[model samples]
Target: MKFNIKNRVTLLVSVWMMSFTMNMLEGVCSIPSSLEVFEHHKNVTGKKWAVLVAGSNGYENYRHQADVCHAYQILKRGGLEDDNIIVFMYDDIAHHPKNPRPGIIINEPNGSNVYDGVPKDYTGEATNAQNFYAVISGNRSALSGGSGKVVDSGPNDTIFIYYSDHGSTGLVSMPEGDDIMANDFMDVLMEKHATNSYKKMVIYLEACESGSMFEGILPNNINIYATTASKASEDSWAFYCPDYGLPPPPEYTTCLGDLYSISWLEDSDKNDMTKETLQQQYQIVRRRTLIGYKDFHSHVMKYGDDKLKNDLLANYIGANPSLDENAYSFEPSTTQTRLVNQRDAHLLHLRLELQMAPEGSKEKLKARQELVDEISHREHVDNTFHLIWDLLRDKNNNSTMMLNVRPPGKPLVDDWDCFRTLIKTYENHCGRLSSYGKKYTRVFANMCNAGIYVEQLKATTSQVSIPLTSSSTQTLDLSSIGSSFPTSATLQELELVTSIDEELLQEYGDELHRFGKVQRVFVVSLKDRSSHMLAMTTSFLKGDYQDELRFFRVHKSDVYESQVAVTKGIGKYDVANGYAEIKVVDKVGFSTKGGKVTNSKFLLFHIYLS
Candidate 1:
């Protein structure tokens, strides 16, 4: 204890040497040698398994399948075996009639074909939520179709999952069957963790509002890491669209890939994975996704097990041993320059189809009709939701909250069952919730948060009704109107009929002649429907007159039916406006058999023109 400083230093060195010798002999030490570290790394034994899914089908949704196929190519190049990779795609893009290059799919403009050698483990109707869950849970017996290949991994395995498709708040759509709910998906992951199915897992989800899947719900303690294309309330964009500078071939009208998807895939393609960490890749991807577009971009979000960010990408996706770190580099300029919102991409496809079809041909006619129907359906969905909100407000006297966005780290709803039941109740009363309509799910969540009862929703929805369009089997019943000719009918009188049938002018024929040679009859249906002077150009039309008159339709009111300005006319008729007094003049009948409209009835009205 009284030794000098020099003697103490000598004694400490001798003690350290003795401890080091004992550690070396026992094969354990606080700091290992380089050779020992290399041996430890080499002894790390685990299989890398991946599940790639494209949750949508059709030529318009080509980007999803293309993304999945390109991911497969990357995984394969990274050294993962085919057996360890399970793919679930609708598999309708390659040989589709709209495909410019049959049996070939490309992820970028003039890019190499990614469709080749892609496995069809699940295709067509087999690409569904049930099969997706079964595959992830490794419950092969639960699978109904496809190859029945599941992610049968052990505790030492590393799992990677990539999904690209249309998503809404708290749900991701599948090509067939029900959508995969966030709660249900998390339940499966929790089960996997509870059973010690894997050492670690990573998920890359690309879709609109994909962040909703993991936000506030995924426990960070689980050995799972997730990255989403967008936050819980926004849309992920589609890149390489026909309008972009680096678009697909001239023959292709749809986008080739999604912005978030191509950012990561291209990064993987041009990087040495063994030298890159998950955090680095995520930063690069997030930056590229935001910088690639000028107007539209998504917030790439990461969730769960933050510590896993330090893990090498090679742990989940095998590394390319042949790749030299210096040979590959990530270039920000390589990202897409233009992006289209995923929801609006379908309109681009439809518009392109209409433009390409020969004018006056049946193809052009069909294309035009389809374009009209799509526009109408969108408007109808908007009106339906608005009506639902109005009804809810009337019942609860609450402030408007349908469009409210939850704060970050907050789940869509506190009660998943309430959210799901409300959606079902809405669909049961209204028609099926189309992909576009899925955006209104936030409204449902808001309602659930407000403690809006399902019975109240059912009652409110039952009172709501959507008008039948040209796509519906019901046709207008004009035969009920007596042949009595009113000298002239004001546009005000016709507005009621317009509300009942927006396509009246297009469907009307000789029946109009019975009313007499009409002067300028400015018949305006839904305000945004069209601007063409359809009535003047009809075969039965005769004379032209002055004084353009415009009128608005009246929506049903449980409280009171007050005359409201439904819409304004375009051009000259804009200034000239009037109000129509709605009075049910006659009643028609409707008969239905086997859910098909056998015969239908409609309200008839009569009014005199100035």
Candidate 2:
């Protein structure tokens, strides 16, 4: 084992090199003084810019605008000048008829008006998704109309963006317009990065399912940090809800702030911005937002650059107390507070309105009906999807309904195109899924998670129909139906109260389609015992009679010849003996030249798919 002097020196050198490599691999722990030379440690050298957007309108959504206005106050106090800040709010709240203080808007209980000095760079319809993207990407031409303000920043600028609104799984609503879908927003961020818009950006989102905006799309290297009020599949909570008996001021009947939003704003208000870091504020806010509401707790989430956590709050918010003369103090209470689900906030408000109104009065009855309708609408959506789920279960032997697969605490469908398509289809047929339709996005998400194709889900929906309950059924006397309404005396209409055979239903199903897609058919039946009839109506496309299902029954007097009359009307060979030939019009709903067309009264003998 004895080695020569040269070998021994080689061994010692090798050992020394190995030790050096190990030290390099496991980064050497350095003292704070030694780390001062690191570029990140040096004070962030940049001018600050901000974009605060409140992407919702209406008085019940008071919290969104209030959140944005409050954030504006914080950034302004932090010394970011008005010239450097861009604000986009619906701007309807300050002067809203519902506002007790017409010109002032408040965030916290008895809080000072954040709306007083706020800028209205993009207001009204101008505060839409198009302007939002335009502002983010600095694309003046992309915006249809607005203040034409955008983020005019360089690599040295730090940008802070705060958006408060109503959000579905992958969409944030813009007032009077389409939503800010995740894909589009992600594209804007990428464009901003490519154009060297900012050195770093901090985004705060206060909306239901806000985390979906960044969940799988945001890249960690994008120099962006996002903190959302709720996770990918949960509702963000609304706080200071007077409807639930917790109001900052007595007259404030709606929610004043989002739980996650107000938590951070209040924390910013109380803490020394110079001393506190963004990480500390996030932790405080996250804790406060999740405190005590375990039954329906919204999990706050953070995405992108973990390193940005150590950045000073003052770097983005501002440290100049002198500039905060208009800012008011906020004391967050841990007790006697309630949180409202964003989807149900308005319903709760209506419920409270009903309770406060004089008993049995018109206003009270109206409020009660509104509350009931709201509740019923939500239930109807759930019930409709449940019906689809039941049909799918029956058709597939209960195999594809996602009953066995457990989803994450929050369920989300990561496929954007598929989700968009499914949602659009639902909207075209069912109605806008926002507000009442928001929560049902999860049904599609579940379908996606279960490895079910959107096409299959849509097709399933097409085949399903809502049957009227026995209690809702009315036995119509066909003889007297539609007699009260005017119709053409030359044409006789016969009402048939009968059920179609499965074979006939299958034949009709083959002809049914959606959006002109020959193969797609969605059947939705009336909740009342109403009948749909297949009419030999004159086609607007061909100017000839075609077989089409008319949900409304035609009366004898209501069936009239068109203003542009045809000598050879719909022949008996083209339709049934008792069937009336009718002309098509440009408007929706079945209308006749007669006095008025009444609703169908016959029990439509339509075939039902098993």
Candidate 3:
């Protein structure tokens, strides 16, 4: 088909050019495009599973349950099915008597009700550490009293877990039972990884010291990513509290949401999941939580697989195509200006209850008593720790050892067993270590780090005798022994011979002789032993000017040989107010015949004031 003169040469060139073009087209078709390779690796068949937990109960802890419910709503809207999501909450907030809106719970001021449609798989007593562990491990047999829903996923599935609660140095609190310890939690995650239960996992934890759950413990190679509301040494703040500028309705008293929780949640609510990466959301949340608040703030921390931060949020949560493009907006100024410390939120709730109760009514009295008890309980916890520290320091001669904090990048304790055993030893002697007491767990960790022995702690704990007031003291029937006694007595006139025991003299000789010669004062009564001897004693010693004006009262009881209940100034003796223990050091030269004393005995009184 070419022209004549150079026809043969032209035809040969045309044929070669056509062959080259055909070979190029064939090569292009043989190799796959970048978009096709990306689609292949996306593995579109993978399913998403989620677990939402609220690890606290009571109206004062309304924010936890509310946070969980809001998270459920987000997952539901993200196209995750109800069957794939498991919810564990105490489920007491929505219908609680203190709830202003009887059937509704909101995460923020003027926010939509998140309480609706939240599954009650684990509620009431079922919301505990055991059940939570079982759920994560997919061990249905280990769970008790719940709907038995667990995160039963395969290797190709993506898992998301969100927990909101009160946390301490190395554990997160549970509603009905033991707390979720950090070591145990990490063990569960490792077991899950070993079993190939999921391809990737993402965790969002909201609690005081939430970062302790994973910091320095979670391995980056485990294919798991976690973001915490606060670092191991800080407190997470609560938002929309009663006194805050962005408070909820006037009828509401408790906080509406936690600061870090609401930041990520509201960000998710407004942003397009497909267009956002987890790292982007974490940055947004961290900024919002740290800024716009002058009084309180917490560091939003991330741990584990840093590479996972690059993945799209839609891979785990999913996206809503119905939302407009402009929905991807965030405003730090819109965030609440006032925030409350998570631990003190309950105090605010109690104070509100006391303030709102009707004046002079039984409700008001009950509220007032409850407030008083709460304050007293906190004082008791503080005092107990202080006493424990004092005793430990006396032995070790280290004043600041118990309160020392480990530097960053180091674990809470080198030996987890020692830390746990010390806590058990303290609890065994002192009583239940309540949520308020959990803050002292770092002290236990420090002791473990310092190589403190459990036996030493036990011995120190035994020596710490908590002061017992009338309400905490046990009742004793002293009616039979009080009939044979004088109505009034003075320490100077009532000269009774007594000898100090050699052991007590050796231990407390200086303290005992500091007041002068040991003098005996006794008073007995059948009725009202604590108050009857109020007017009996006028002075402690006759000659010693330092002890002359000091007043004292002896509370006689059949339970012991002799006990003194002394007051400092001249006032009515109220046993309910205070008392001192008088230990019997020795009993010498006493002879009893036919239930009557035949000979005088030298009785020693060891005075120990608390």
Candidate 4:
């Protein structure tokens, strides 16, 4: 099944005409001077290089990849060679099973096939933060896959970077993996500056809360200029939406372009690239992306060197060597100008699928379930965070939690360490905080605004527990007993205490019966993002003070404070495969596995230590 649509011929023709018009507008005398200036720049600035990245995958996110391909097309037409332009996209949408057009991708409602010649320098899982940095820093040794083509640029080169993806405050999601944190990304830029990788750089990003990447952290003197689709607190929008009158192909059910993305690209397509200054282009994109739609929009923002706005678009995007006066031009009708929130596009498509599906059919049922799950997942995440908030408020009787912080959204402070600790604590106790957990980030911001410490929040949430016996109990003070019992005490001491109170020992293995006070618990998840392995401090036994348990893949420098003991008979049961057992032996370094055993590993366990 494929959508039968012609690649817009005018797209190429307009490029030629626009370039011609720009040259014409510049006048004959201006052309020689402009060439002289560019030639001088070429001598000083080695080459122009671009890194185009679309940080998402799947059929539903067609627009992101399409936007990147379109950007590549513009840069290519502008004169940058393929080797100078590095592209990072999942490269899955064009031929996706669900794609209406098997080998084609369009940016606008009735646009050209932008995907035809886009480079696949890096694709799939390789399009991650690690690879992105490896490419930017020209460290081929750090690259994981693809052709391993890096920028290979020097201080004399000019760099342009464009990234389109799903983003939240301080983080951007990478497909099927962890996110790219703003601080880490800034570190990469600082590294580039420190190494003199380029003379000047330009960055354009399209994502929900894209501005957060540069709003406060990006330094202005770093020779980098940036623009984002929206402010840190808002969602970027999609254009040519479901209600755009022209129905999408039968196999597709969503918008064709991102609002801010298409606004700038289309402006480039229509106007003269040579004549268009970056400032003029920004004004055009800002106006159309925001006010023209009158439906859904976001505040497009710019950061870094404001003077760079006067530079020619050709300096970054490139310009054609010659133009054609007889080229074709295009202007979309009002019917094609609808918009929707980019973050909600997939969910909206699923709902539309269910709405349009035949009643009680398999397709209808499948769509219904997907829609329900999507909504339910979001609600579940919100409910979980709200539960944590309520529990903490109730436990501490802190009326400050009742503060009205909702009407006007609050900005997240640059306190990355605070937010990271708080998020880790929640995940350590609750579960893996996935994409849905991102919506709760603002709650952490609110907590920070309320002057709450991360430890205090951790303590409040740690109070939640499941009843283990007929009598409910609060946190236990085992440090007092630890004072009398030395780490070198006989094995009989361990047996004597457990034997004396077997019930209490069995009730809480991870927390309650502590011989010496537990200092910290470190949780490690597999690199494949699967099951979690836990390590906890058992006693202050000097060299061999801690105990290690279970299995999860560890990274190169993943250091846990505890000792390492590879549990034997580990493969006998796999948790993800539905069979697992966990036990805490009276003696250290003892391992037992086989049958499914229920313990703290499978339950929500808490730990509080002095």
TM-score list, all predictions:
0.74, 0.67, 0.73, 0.66
TM-score of 2: 0.67
lDDT of 2 at 569: 25
Steric clash pairs (candidate 3): none
Q: Could you give candidate 3's per-residue lDDT for residues 1-610 as a string of tens digits?
A: 1243265346445555655666688784243332332233345547788999999999999999999998998888877888889999988899998898999999887788899888899999999999989999999999999998899989999999999989999999998878898999999999999999999999999998888888789999989999999999899998889877678887997998998998888888887776688999999999877875755788999999987887778778766444534332445565436778899998888788877777779987687656655664675567567766876777788766566767777788888888878988987776657767788888898888776899998866655532232222223233332322233444323333222222122112111123333333332232564422312222233343234212244433323344444344322222222333333221212223465432122223334333
- What is the lDDT, from 0 to 100, of the residue 11 in candidate 2? 44
Q: lDDT tens digits, residues 1-610, model 1?
A: 2244355357446656665787989997755442343223434657789999999998999999999999999888877889989999999999999898999999988688999899999999999999999999999999998997899999998899999999999999998988999999999999999999999999999999999999999999988999999999999999888866568888998999998998888778877776688999999989977765656688999999987887778778777545433222334455436668898898788778877777679987787666656665676678667867887887788764487888899888999999999988887766667778898888998999887999998866655543333221221223332232222334434432222322222212211113222223233333543321112211122233232333333233121212322123323444433333332211122223364321111221222232
Worst 10 residues of 1 by lDDT: 532-541
lDDT (C-alpha) at residue 461 in model 4: 50
In model 1, residue pairs whose N, Cα or C atoms come closer than 3 Å (at least 3 residues apart or on different chains), thus clashing, are: none
> Distance (Å) between predicted and true CA of 349, model 1?
0.5
C-alpha lDDT score of every prediction, in listed order: 0.73, 0.64, 0.72, 0.63
User: Cα miss at 235, model 3 (Å)?
Assistant: 0.5
Better model by TM-score, 2 or 4?
2
Cα distance off (Å), candidate 3, residue 351: 0.7
Candidate RMSDs in order: 11.4, 16.1, 14.1, 17.1
Score candidate 4 by TM-score against the native.
0.66
Write candidate 2's Cα lDDT for 1-610 as tens digits.
2244355357446655655666678896423221222222224467778999888888888889999999998878777789879999988888998788899999977788889788879988788888888888878888877677788888888889998888877788888577888888998999899888789999999888788788877888989999999888678888878745346676765788888888788778777676677788888877767764545468889998877887777777777354333334444455555668888788666756666667658976586556645554555566566656775666556554533323443325656677677777766655567575676665666566656676776665554322222332222243443422224321223432122121111112212222110111112123353322323222222333333322224322222221111112233323222223222111111122354332221121321111
Higher-scoring candidate on TM-score, 3 or 4:
3
